[model samples]
Target: MTRRRPRPYDRELQNLRLHVGHERQGPVPVGWYFARFSRHLRRGEVVPVTYMAQEYALFRTRGGQLGMIDSQCCHMGADLGRCGRVSEERLVCGFHAWEFDRDGTCRKIPGAGRIPSRAAQRSVPVTELGGIIWFWHGSPAPEPLDELDFAEDRRRHLYLAGEVLVCHADLLPIGEHVTDASHWAYTHSPGRPMTSVQLRDEGRRFSFLIQPADADDTRIYHFRPYTLISMASPTTAVAVPQPGPRPDGKPPRMAFVAAVSPVRPGVTLATWSLVVRKFGPDWLLWPANRLWAAFLWRLVRRNHHADFDILRWMRPVAKDLWSVADGPTVRAYRRFYRRNLPPAMEEGAEERVSGMS
Candidate 1:
């Protein structure tokens, strides 16, 4: 008897199944994610980072280069983040003075002249942008961070909000919040109907515009996959509010980029980074820009409070319900998730992705 070949797995079908709120299970998608604020890690400093259920020793060497390696020292399983020191361009283990290069190779071992063949520690790819330190949670030779359209803007000016808040939430829901038009009225602005929503789908990304009934400002949202961004999980979202003209007759331009990273299964840390166009000289515009960005951060913080209250305890549940009021942008976002999913992850495993355990 001849056996028939099995059909290929359908990502679109899987996307639709999960879109309607079907319980999702599998390995989390691989991508860049915010690990810590760049300022917090000064030169020659080592910090501990726990994300995606793995611990890392994120360090800035004396030479001003960044590296992330397994937090544990192989000598005796000592926590590297707690006992390691950055020496010039390498991490020196305090336990036995075992030195490791950025590539996870053990170069020196104190007292003993010979190093073990398996004394090397695992290292993760890391980059710095927009005042955030990010690490890749997938395969080696990660994509370049400069590929992001806003890369220059983030690097040139201050982009981070002063405070980063941690919440018990899912990555997808938090990233898709900007595209969720229906909930704005009830969740963010009461009595202001967010009924006038328009969308422009660009396959990999989709932009939407919204004008609330009680507000004069027009809000625009850009949602896309976070494959190369400095701060995003599987998806990245940006929201811009176009308010009326200022006293100078020129409308102020600013955007809030939502950056979220999954710390574990259901817990995520989210923050808003402000991006503004420079108006005047650097000496004057720099301070003004920071103040303006800080003001906007407060607004974002207030708005997200409502979201945190609801998302903190919510689980990924599928409802056999559909409504046009949810808008096309939401549907497009669901499709985006379906197409961008990674292979099923191992269940209850220490090493969920490559370079992480």
Candidate 2:
């Protein structure tokens, strides 16, 4: 039998490069918006959803319906969030008493001789799923929501979640922070010696393998309905596999899952979760777990602060202006960006022209 020659790693790297640049101005991929938690807008609350900094009124009906409409009253542009009221499942603009239904149709215009047919036509696309409100701004045509798949054994874990609005910074920078492993060495040192330096460095070499949830063959289990396992990277060849079923017989529901969405161009809503097994269903366990999670949350918060400082400085420049560090995962990420971002943006032509002129 003849043995085939092993494929070269450099060849794989070349194929994976995604040339991202800032010149081709269009909306970022819509995958960036789905499944993001909007905490300010409580259940059955109406709030404004802004894209690229422009506002659109978003609301959920008492019957568990979702809706989005122009933030201004069609008659006299009044800020809806400040002066709007939900009456009988319709959003009434306070300035001129214009009423819009769940579909964004102008249901009533008080004292108008006759409501124009066009008044009832305009509506923005919206979707509600798994405790999230999603507004589709790209096109009128609807697209299927991304589905999440979990392995059978992993499905038994319960999940817990929380959302916070950072005072500064956008979603992209924060999402990128998750892939940054070097920060853990210094910022997350916490006076403890690095026990997993090699693993950390190795993990950083992996790039995001985006696929439909149905296509992903990863395990996802959660401690609660809200907590979900998103994806997991395969173990490295050199690493020893930890024992399963845990010493306690109850394994965590989800090892890790993060769903980060860009609520608007400048603002981001990140929904993250941790899965744990039901520890006897005792009410006491809830508080105990929360306190422990809070400690972990603080560590994460400090690391985010460090990353925010770095990314905030780099945001003004095109991503192409940056260089990938010498690591397998970092190189893979650079390649992915190079291939996905438009050629013009990847070349930084926009920045170059702006500087020259």
Candidate 3:
């Protein structure tokens, strides 16, 4: 598909999160990545981050610890992220040399004789894991990254760090794309859909059985038939909690995982990763090699990037949803979002779209 470059939205609608109520953004989760991607930040550095619907400042201390607080300083409401400097594990305000410790306690005010007990700024918890820094958005402690147990076992698979890009759009399209199994038949296949979809782990994991190779079948989506039976088991195709276990008592061929965070109105940032087998063919089937893992990663990356243009501009509207079979799968996620996460926008603050109702 030919891709179109993203055009900027209306100026007034840029910071949609700031103006709109949180409820309209859909059950926007309160998990990590609000500081967008933070593993790159080092000590004594102050950076501004927009999370969910608000902007905040992140500070790194001397010993490689991170703290999240409001971007504006408590004193005189100065933009702390602009000129703030760290002083011995503390973030000092640029305007008045006000120093805040890793806990956000305003310990020093320079010439001020008395340090007010209320001078402290409330902070969100921060944790660095697996090269990504996670920060809690709400009051509770941030949950550690839901990493796969298999990831720790290096003997099984080799992981390739992939691309990270920011998009200006909503996530509903993404939710729809994954569940739209029919698209596989038209865009990625030779007019044949997936053969089976088995739910596992209380609907958290999935096992997709695609139609095996045929002479008439053309693999447009980069989905090659499993040449190796061990690496291509139908047991663990695409899962949420983790890919399903190999029924043949083996590891996965590769995995594609991506997440999108809505930080501003008409703006979002996402992270992606691909993992494959560390070694070449193990028990054998069709004489496959270790490079199969990397090949799968490239295919996954190509397939997703093909949709980037549409994803960046697709608006989340009820009228666009199409499906009967996949409805339950997509709705389940939205239901969980509504019940657990807060809405991303207020009803009145939503962007006024004209054509696409």
Candidate 4:
């Protein structure tokens, strides 16, 4: 059998090997319904976006679809997000009254009385599901976004059981931890070795079963990594670029979902949906859920602290090492990124992001 090693020139992995701290690289994946922008943005609103190290304006049209373009208006360098309006499925720049469609095609120019030949805003494809907006970070695909649905019900996600964890770190590393089980002690550890950890990977999605090293250890953990595995448990987990929409429409509920979104060069946001179900007694569902919820929130917060302890300051890139729990899953994910997304817009690759190349 042949062993697989990462390409020698993969800069993202190389930087991780060299331990250069935190840097945002890699093309953001397609089909991810980003909830980070869902809070303040409503239909017919535009929000400035500086995600994946590129500048963009994410506007929700009245029809409830999302449209994206370079935040700067086509006429002058005014930030469209600051004073942008949506007229039907288009965005009207407050600066010049320029109107652009969902694909950034300029349809109305008040001054020119006709759309100029070069009056179009750069178009980025967008779709929405689960009460969240999603845009592709790669060349547009030929499928409609309604076909790209979220596996989890982002709309009805029980609020008491969930919280969003934001940090100034790129999302890839944090998202990768879901499959890297042995390292549980390094950060979210209970200060004891997990009895046994096993992983199963089925291409786009993978899961882990974490067990305490000893039954005699006899310690109960509020948030055992076990329940965070899939939809079967009272707990469920949905990671980004998670398994595509299910045919049965019964996507596994997630106990924790880390949806990654970029804010700027050195800042990133992850919506960590930590869902904790109530006790078996139906009567305890209300009053008891609160304290239990707080305990779960603390678990998530501590885990976040453990992650940010290094991620908050370290600029990390991928390093090709498959020596951890279910290493193949991590390798597969990295392969997916390198295969589907274009090179990260670094140094001077900004044109690629803005040009839709």
Candidate 1 vs candidate 3: the TM-score winner is 1
How much lDDT does candidate 4 score? 0.51
lDDT (Cα) of model 1 = 0.61
Query: Which residue ranges in model 1 land beyond 4 Å of their true spot?
Result: 1-26, 145-148, 151-156, 195-233, 241-253, 284-287, 318-320, 344-357
Cα lDDT tens digits for candidate 2, 202-303: 321332321112323222231111111122211101111123211222233323444444434444444444334444444657676656656655544554
lDDT of every model, 2 decimals: 0.61, 0.43, 0.51, 0.51
* Superposed Cα RMSD, model 3: 8.7
TM-score of 2: 0.56
Per-model TM values vs. the true structure: 0.73, 0.56, 0.66, 0.63
Q: Give the lDDT of residue 154 in candidate 4.
A: 35
lDDT of 2: 0.43
Relative to the unseen true structure, what is the C-alpha lDDT of residue 333 in candidate 4, on a scale of 0 to 100? 44
Candidate 4 regions off by >4 Å? 1-35, 87-89, 140-156, 159-172, 195-207, 213-219, 222-254, 262-267, 274-299, 317-357
- For candidate 4, lDDT tens digit of each residue in 120-141? 7786666544434556555445
The top-ranked prediction according to TM-score is: 1
User: Per model, how many backbone clashes are there?
Assistant: 2, 26, 10, 13
Best by lDDT: 1
| Model 4 lDDT at residue 153 | 48
